[model samples]
Each structure stands twice: as C-alpha cells, then as structure tokens.
Target: MQTFFIGFFGLAAVVFAVGVFRTSSMMRSALALLFSQTALGALFLAMQAEFLGVLQIMMMATEMSIMAIFMVMFMMDPGGLGGMDMSHQKRLSLLAGLGGVVLVTGIAAYTQWEGLASATEAAAADEQIRQLGRELLGRSMLVFETAGITILTAMIAATAVAVKVPEQGGSHES
Candidate 1:
C-alpha cells in the first residue's frame, strides 16, 4: 500500500511537471505547481515524515493558492487565456530554458547519487510531530515569520504598483 501511494505520488509529480512545462496560461501553470507541491507533500507523508508533510501542505498548498489568487487579481488577464506579448526576448527565453535543464539535471544526479538511506528511517508519529513542532517554534520560528512578512510586503507593493490613481485637480486648472 505504501509503495502504491508513493508510485501514485510520483506519477502525479510527473504529470504536474509536464503541465508546468507545456501550459502557456499562467493560471494553468499555477494549478500545476500546486498539484506538484501536493504530490510532494503526499510523498513526505508516505515516508512517515508526518510533520514535514503537514507543513508542506500548509505552507505550499495554502500559501501558493493565496499567491495565485493575488496574481489573478492583479494580472491584466486573470484567466491567462488571452494572447501574450512574446514578440521580444526569444534569446532570454532560450537561455532560461537551458539553465532550467542544467539545474534539473544537476538535481537528478545529486538525488540519485545521494540515495535515500536516511529518508527510510522510521519513528513514532507522536515523537516526530513533537520534535518538528519544537524545532519549528524554537529554532525556525523567526525564519518562518520573516518569510510571511516578506510575502505580505511583496503583495502590498505589487498592488500599489499595479493600481492606477486619478488626479484630483479639475480639467479647468489646465
């Protein structure tokens, strides 16, 4: 059953990756990214890392959804089905693709070589959860709060930059 769940998660991850790469619409890409993160969280749960799994779901899934909603609200075409302005920056796109391929390959090689010996270690759920909560609040609390603040600031800045304000002066003043 565990193997089956893991395999399912792997398949879902692959599908999500394909969607991310192939979809042109920003909304579709965001959905695909969400699916991929969910699959990753499931994989963590399957490995008995319950705390990490929950954190992944809470932070990635929920947070990403909110981010996507903000993006949709601010974007010129929220649905992202409209034609895009891609007339320029072909070279930049090609360079980015090449960089992404290299990074993916590097990650694949590292994971394959490092293996998963430690990932298979088992522990009681209660203990694991306790340790995770302690570490999160004790050591990583500041980092987590800082990240939240950063996200909030970015959202505010984006909204302010995107919104257009009208002048208060009357036309007769000209």
Candidate 2:
C-alpha cells in the first residue's frame, strides 16, 4: 500500500515536472511547478516523513504563488498568448540532464543502506519533531530569517514595478 502510494506520487511528480518544462506559458509553468512540488510532498508523506511533507507543501505553495505573481507582473506575455518558445540550449540541456540522472542513479545504487540506523535506534516521532524544531529555530534560524527578508523585499519590488505612476506632463497640479 505504501509502495503503491509512493510510486503513484513519484510518477505524478515526474509528469508535472515535465509539464513545467514543456509548457511555453509562464503562468502554466508556475502552476506545473506547484503541482510537481505538491506531488513530491505527497511522496514524502507516503514515505512517513510527515514534517518534511508538510513543510514542502507549505513552502512550495507560498513560493510558487509569489513566482506566479511576479511572472504576471513582469513578463510581457505571462499567459504565453504570443505562443513563444520558452526553452533554450536544447542539446546541452538534454545531455546535462541525462548525465545528472545517470550520476544520481549510480550513487543511489552504490550507497550502502544497511549501515544506517535501524528501527530500534530510530527516535520516536514526537522527539524527532522536537529535535527538528530546535534545529530549525536554533542554528538555522538566521538562514530562515534571511530568506523571509529577501522574499519580503522581492514582494515589495514586484509591487513597486506593478504600480502605474502618473505621467509628469499629463497630470499638472494647480
């Protein structure tokens, strides 16, 4: 049952990932990415990584929404109404992608999984969650804070760009 769900979500993630690249529309691409990330989160949940799954879903939802907003604001044709091609360097990109897949597959195949901690050595769910909270809010707090500030800055910039200023010559004050 678990394996089935993992496989299902994994396949869905791959399909949506392909959709992200295959679509020419910026809005569609962003939506595809959101679906892909959500599928990955579901895969994590199927694998029993509750915290990671929830975090992935929440973070990607917010990130992708912001991305879509920025795209709509900044892009000349965010919906791809012009039907322009979005991809570039096809041959090189294909080779690089293939190489990455082969390398990752080799690594996964060669790694010794038995050396990792067994179920007996594994911490309980509540304890693991507490440790994760401490780890994130402790040493990793600065990184999260920086990311938050950066996102806020970007949102402000996007808003500024989207705003339409009055023409200097057209609007004369008395």
Candidate 3:
C-alpha cells in the first residue's frame, strides 16, 4: 500500500540522515546523505509527487557524487580508516539541533494545514510542471545555461585553489 511505502521511505530517510551525522568518514557521511535524499525522493513518490521525487533523486545524485569526488580528492583520509574525529563543537551542535527540532515541532503543531489536495489541483500541479519544463527549455534556457556556467567556473576555481604546485627544485608532496 501507498501508506506503507511512504512510512518505510520516511523511516529510511530518517535513519540515513542520522547516519550522515553519526559517521566519522567523509565519504560515508556523503553516502549516507545521498541515501537519505534518495529515500526522501522515494517518500515523495510514494505520496504521488512524481516531479519532486524524480527531481530530488536526480539532483541529489549528481550533487552527492560531486561531493564524494571532492572529498576523496581533498581529504587526507576520506574513508576514516585512520579513526579521525569528524565532528566539532559537539555541545553547540547538539543544542542547535535540538533547538531547531523544538522550533519546527512548535511551528508544525501551531500551523493550520489546509487538508488534502483535490483532483483538479493535482492535475493543475502536473500541468504546472509541464509549463515549468517548457519555460526552462525555452525562455529560461539562457538563465539556466548561465547558472550552469557559473557553477562550473566556481568548481574550477575551487580545484585550482586546492591544487598545489611544486617548487622548481622541490618534489611535489601528496
């Protein structure tokens, strides 16, 4: 049933999200975050939001893949095989996380949620997605292209900054 799958994916997402924070390895943390995002996408799909589910999966897949690659390239020990401590400011982080949870819970409990969507609204949402796709590939294509180029430029700049050049008479160090 849809409810069962939604619950399953939701639980899976929460578990993987916890794994992201609990892991000591940068690579494992990135992988856990990826799994969490993918589970959230599955949750959306179980709830019948096709566009969001697919988008979440696709975007997170690419982003996390890039993040893992960067981690492997930049980290001294991305795999945590050396038993490195990856977390910092533990008390502050815990307090902040708890505060966030309390705030969100309060808001959710106090907010007025407007019931379920009707069939017509659902259809309109689907149509909106189609219109959005058209605009993205049509009038908004230039903007998207520009954004893509900007991101690529930033990535290149980061890579350049991260790279080290050897001296004329010295050897390069890993």
Candidate 4:
C-alpha cells in the first residue's frame, strides 16, 4: 500500500512538474507548479515525514499564489489569450535534461550513504513532533531564519513585479 502510494504520487509529481513548463499560460504554469509540489508533499507523507510534507505543500501554495498574482498584474497576457509562444530551445533542453537524469541515476546507483538512522529509531508521534519543534527552534534556528527571509524576499519581489509607477498626468485615485 505504501509503495503503491509512493509510486503514484511520484509519477504525479513528474507529470505536474512537466505541465508547469509545458503550458503556454503563466497562470496555468503556476498552478501546475503548485500541484507538482503538492504531489511531492504526498510522497513525503508516504515516507512518514509528515511535518516536512505539509510544509512543502503550504509553502508552494503560498509562493505559487503570489507568482500568479504577480504574473496577472505584470504580464500583458497572463492567461495566454494571445496564444503566446512558450516553447524554447526544446532539443537542447531535452538533451540537458537527459544528461541530468543519467548523472542522477549514476549517483543513486553507486553512492553509499552512511550512518543513516532507521525509522524505528525515531520517537513516537507526539515526541517526534516535539523533537522536530525543538530542532527547528533551537539547533536549526538558522534554517528557520533563512526560510523566513526567503518568504520575505519573495513577497518583496512580488510587490516589485506587480506594482507600476503612476503616469505623471494620470491619477490613480478616483
């Protein structure tokens, strides 16, 4: 059952991720990215990383919403109503993508990851949650701070992308 779910969402993640770039519309691309990230979150759940899974989904949902908003505000055809050309360097991208896959496959096949703890070593649910909290707020303070900074930066960038200077002779207020 676990294996089935893992494979299902793993495939879904790939499909939605591809959909992100395959679509012509910026809004649709953002939505596809959101679904791809959510699929990854489901995979994480299958592996029992519940906290990280939920965090992944929530962060992507927020980030993609912001991206869609900025696109709609800034782009002339956010919905691809003009049937804008979205494809670019297709053959080169495919070759590079294939090379990347081969490299990753080689690494996964040959690498020996050492000293990883088994799932049984982890505490029960409540204790695991407390441990995660302690690690995030205490020993992993830098990570938390970095995540906060990243979110702040994204918000700032969205505002910058979406906002336009008013015309000198025109009034924004009515």
Candidate 3: residue pairs that collide: none
User: TM-score of each candidate?
Assistant: 0.60, 0.73, 0.71, 0.76
- What's the lDDT of the predicted structure labeled candidate 4? 0.89
The pairs that clash in candidate 2 are none
Cα-based lDDT at residue 1, candidate 2: 100
lDDT of 2 by residue, 68-167 (tens): 9999999999999898886789999999999999999999999997797466444656787998889889999999889999999999998999799866
Residues 1-174, candidate 1: write the lDDT tens digits. Answer: 999999999789878977875655667778898889989999989878888888898888887788789878878875657756534687898799789989998998878655655565687989987887887788999997898999999999999998998777698677
TM-score order, best first, reads 4, 2, 3, 1
- RMSD versus native structure for model 2: 4.6
Q: How many backbone clashes does candidate 1 have?
A: 0
Q: What is the C-alpha lDDT of each candidate?
A: 0.82, 0.91, 0.89, 0.89
Which candidate leads the pack in lDDT? 2
The runs of at least 3 residues in candidate 4 whose Cα sits more than 4 Å from the true structure, single-residue gaps closed, are 113-122, 142-174
Residue-wise C-alpha lDDT for candidate 3, range 9-119, written one tens digit per residue: 999999999998887799999999999999999998887778889999999999999999999999999998898886789999999999999999999898866564335
lDDT ranking from best candidate downward: 2, 3, 4, 1
What's every prediction's RMSD, in angstroms? 4.7, 4.6, 5.1, 4.6
lDDT score of residue 150 within candidate 3: 100
